[model samples]
Target chain A: MPAIIELRDVTKTYKLGDETLNAVDGISLSIQTGDFVAITGASGSGKTTLANIIGGLDRPTGGSVMVDGNDLSKLRDRKLSDYRNQHIGFVFQSFNLQGTQTALENVTLPLVFARVKSKARKQRATECLQAVGLGDRLKHKPSQLSGGQRQRVAIARALAVKPNIIIADEPTGNLDSQHGDEIIKLLRDLNKQGITLIIITHDMNIARQAGRIVQVRDGKVRA
Target chain B: MRLVDYISLALRNITRRKLRSALTIFAIVIGATSVTIMLTIVFSAKGFINDQFEQNGTFQQVQVSPQTDINWGNGSGQNCNSSDCVKLTQALINKLAKLPHVIGIARQTQPYNFDGLFYGSKKLKLNQVVAYDANGIIDNHMLAGRDITQSDGNGVLTITSDYADGLGFKNNYQALIGKTVKLHTQGYYSGVGSDPVGRQQYMQTHCQNMGPGQNCELPSVQITGKVVGIADANGLTNSSGYTVRVPLSWARGMEENQDYGPARTSGDYCRNMPGPCMPPNVLTVTDELALNGYSSLIVKVDNATNAAAVAQNIRGTFKIGAADAETAIKQQLSVFNIVGIILGGLGGIALIVAAVGVINTMVMSILERTREIGVMRAVGARRSAISRLFTFEASLLGMAGGILGVLIGYGLTLIGNPILNHQLKGNNIGSSNILSLPIWLVITVIAGTTVIGMLAGLYPARKAAKLDPVEALHYE
Candidate 1:
């Protein structure tokens, strides 16, 4: 089967005043369609940088990353953001739901940028929240919601555009054991429904459940 | 994004910081209110000049007189001695007719004092007899009968209806038409240099040398003219004078027959009478009209616009004291325009301050919403859309402020008018309302303020638009 994401010697660098550091150095990886892939690394081992490169949030300094048949390095800022809007959903480690907006409004943000009508945005956002088990908390603001529910709202937001890939960058990092397991299971259930799910985490236990685990150490992927 | 969505989002943002938005809008309201009020006063002042001339129907003609010591203001009236006065001569009149834009030039005969009005031997000895070209008398108020046209009776003269009533005519004075009162005249040149009372006495002196209805040695010329029309009893002339008008040819004929010499002592010579003159007031008459030229010339132009140019030309050409109503209007309006611009600019300073306030508020709002803008950019929203959002927010503030300002301005005018008018009337200024805002001006002020507000937002909106999404997301 053809791979959904392809990375060929991808390298991301950083300037630390005088020294140059490669955050994602010479990474070459491929993940097939409908596969659950876990990128496991220590805090500074560059898993998040690799996720950013694949998610089109940041550009690689060298080599090309092909995602769903589009060259990620060649896209302009607008085209890159549009590609993320149409095909990739990002779930931040801290659950970046807008605190001022209601749960439903937070979920509706992607669809808003998608140029969806208000009525349709509302209908789809409501359904997405129900899918994430936060249907009853639609009108509640992030401040009013529990930590678990806020993460659920973030997940609902990621699902609002019906993107082809779900990229969860340490999705359960801020949650306790019970909330973390529940969020992981929800992500597992979404992947079982045939969406490609990539989890960027250092937790060995979470990586064990993925169909494949790519271990990142010293900015390189090891089999 | 759709326009409605932009407005919706802006509205929500505005309500989030209620006090700041209100304060910003309030500043603009004060600025726009003053601007609108100043414009109103300026427009009203221009209306005053038109109103003044319209009431008298004298807006179409320019008054030209030979350059002299007197300028025709309302009070400094015909104080010049007409007998010794240099006239706007027929030669000059012919020359004036050839001037561009001059439709026609009219001249008035110098007034002849009343000696006797003989209605079949019934005479009313009275004040001076006045004569002018009929067309020149268009502004006069006609009380009865038709105005004297060149096609009228051989010699037609109009008098005040009040004067006609005293002449044994109908109470209405319309019945005075066709009544022949033989006008008896002699050269009353001596009286022309003196006061009215002295002139009255000089005019009654009969020229004995000339037989009845024949020529007097003082060149007494009599003409029996039918009373054509009666004018109102108001001040006869614009400045004040003649109650009668005659054709130019008749006045010219009268001018030719009189003595053109200077004033003389009464007992100089009586060719037909013996020894010292028997009559007390009788004197040798001198013809003033022939000595000088015509006292004034009325130049009719194409319209009010051309009237000013013609008056300027006449002032330049004949070097005379001349005024067209249109020139006066333009002068008055330009003064109003200057005053209006100054006052409007003074008021506009408030708007500039408000604009700065808008910029400050927009910058603060963008800072507060930096993270939100970043999130939007990370999604599908473009840089232009982010800028548009902030600009729309600022413009919304201005539009609301403009609407409120227009209301406040209109309300102030409504309440201020009667109060201002009372003070104006007390101060002897005109009673017209000073705050009369036209509809187009009101619309323009509101629209213009909104544009200004949008322009004020440009810098802050650009700052917001250029913010890096990755960096903005990391901000606390």
Candidate 2:
């Protein structure tokens, strides 16, 4: 299959006092369409930064990031945000759901930014929740849900826009072993349905389940 | 995003912090209400005064005073015997009549010798007894009967409603019309209608017995006249506050000074005869009206626009004071304007303080919603959209306050008008509901508050829009 995302010598630096740290170092990688890839690293090893650059959430200091034929490095904020909305969905490990809103409302957030009508947004959010086995939990707020259920709700929110790629940054870091396995199974099922999935994790068991594993250390990647 | 979505979202945000939004709006309401009420009063009073002048035809008439520095609406003209004092005489009136835009002239005078007016023993102090040419140049708001016309001669007059009230007529002014009223002169009065023969006999009998430089008391004369009209005391533009008007003919007669004097033939006869011969007594009449000229002349112009020009012409040609009411009205209205500015400025200060409240509230809201803004931006909301949303929310606060304030102001007018009307009626003024709020005022107040809100929102909205999404999303 053709490559859906390509990065060439990507670098992201942060200034801390007088010391410049390269959070994302000069590294090149490619991921194909419908590919299930896992990026494994120790803490502070820049795996999350790589995921963010791929999702268009943060810009690299020097790099050409090509996603589905669009050069993200050259895009302005408006187009970059549009790329994130239309093509990429992010799932945080903390299940970053609005504690004040219902699961369905949280899912509708992306669709609202996409300018979907309210009725259609609701319908699509319901379908996404149902796909995540959370159809009956649509009206439940994050505080009312279990940790596993809240993660599933976050996944449903990420799935609402029907994006081309899903970036899961330590998707199961906060869950117990059983809940963590359920979340990984849900993401693997979604990957099987032809959505390219990238999981950032330190767990070797989760990384071994992916079709490909890229282990990152000291801001460099080794496949 | 659609405008509806933006508004809905903004409304939801505002509702989230209901107490803060309401408090902010309350401050604006106070400012708007004060501005509304103050401006309404000033504008309405200005409108009322203009309406009064328009009804009286004062705008079309130019008053010519003998004094060079005379102002319109003042009846005190120059009554000097000096040659420098320009007398408003018949010759000047004729020359003024020939001036461009001159339509007609009404000579005005006040008889100063009257002490009281008697209606069936109910004596009332005469404040002013005025006479003017019944040439339709002067208008009176008659309560009953008709104004003194050109045909009205001696013994015909019009008394104001205050006189009627003192005469026990009060609201029944019609009953006083056509009734005989006596005007009593002062003790030393020797004007028209005095008994010169009686005065001479009294002097002959009393003066001989009194020592030199001793004074002899003269009985006051009572002149009778029929009330032709009862006018509103506060309705006359030139003469207000308890006035009584009489025909010019009667005033001419009243102003005559009658005196007892020796006949012209007696002087020669007494010179040729023995020393014991007495001079024949005769009565002489002096025309004081002709001697003093009319106090002031009201020259009517063909149009109100030409009144100023005619006044200028009269001032230039006759060297007398000719003032159009427009100038004086403008001068008077400027006082209202000054008062309006002062009052409106007070309201503006309140609004500015309220705007500060809005800014504080918005800045606080932005701080609280920083994470939400980041989430929205990540989901694809443009920076402009976020900025617009916050601005809309602020404007909504302003709009709500403006509407509420205007309603409260309208309610106050409703409550205030009746009391004002009662006071005006007590003062004999006929106008009512002088606290009107025009549509433009309502619109301006609302729009002004909305604009103020938008301005106050700009800073906070810009701050919100410029926040970094990555940093904000992880904000604690």
For every model in order, what is the number of clashing pairs? 2, 0
Can you list the residue pairs that collide in candidate 1?
A: B132-B245, B216-B219
Candidate models: Cα lDDT each: 0.75, 0.87
Q: What is the lDDT of residue A186 in candidate 2?
A: 99
Candidate 1 lDDT by residue in tens digits, A84-156: 8888888888787777789999898888778889999999999999999887989999999878888899888
How does chain B score by TM in each prediction? 0.56, 0.77
- Candidate 2 per-residue C-alpha lDDT over B153-184 given as tens digits, one digit per residue, 9 for 90 to 100: 88899988877888899879998888999998
Backbone clash tally for model 2? 0
Clashing pairs in 2: none
Compose the digit string of candidate 1's lDDT tens values, residues B1-476. 67777888888899888999999999999888878877777776666556555645566677776554333323112313545434566677888889887777666545554465666756655444544566643456787876677655346777665457557664657667767767666544233232334444333575434467765444444567778777765434443222345555555444443332323544455556786664334334444465566666667777766877887787777766678776666766888788878778876898899999999999998888877876776565777778899999989888888888889889988998899877854443434476777898789889978997899989999999888776676577
Docking class of 2: acceptable
Which CAPRI tier for candidate 1?
acceptable
Name the candidate that leads on lDDT. Answer: 2
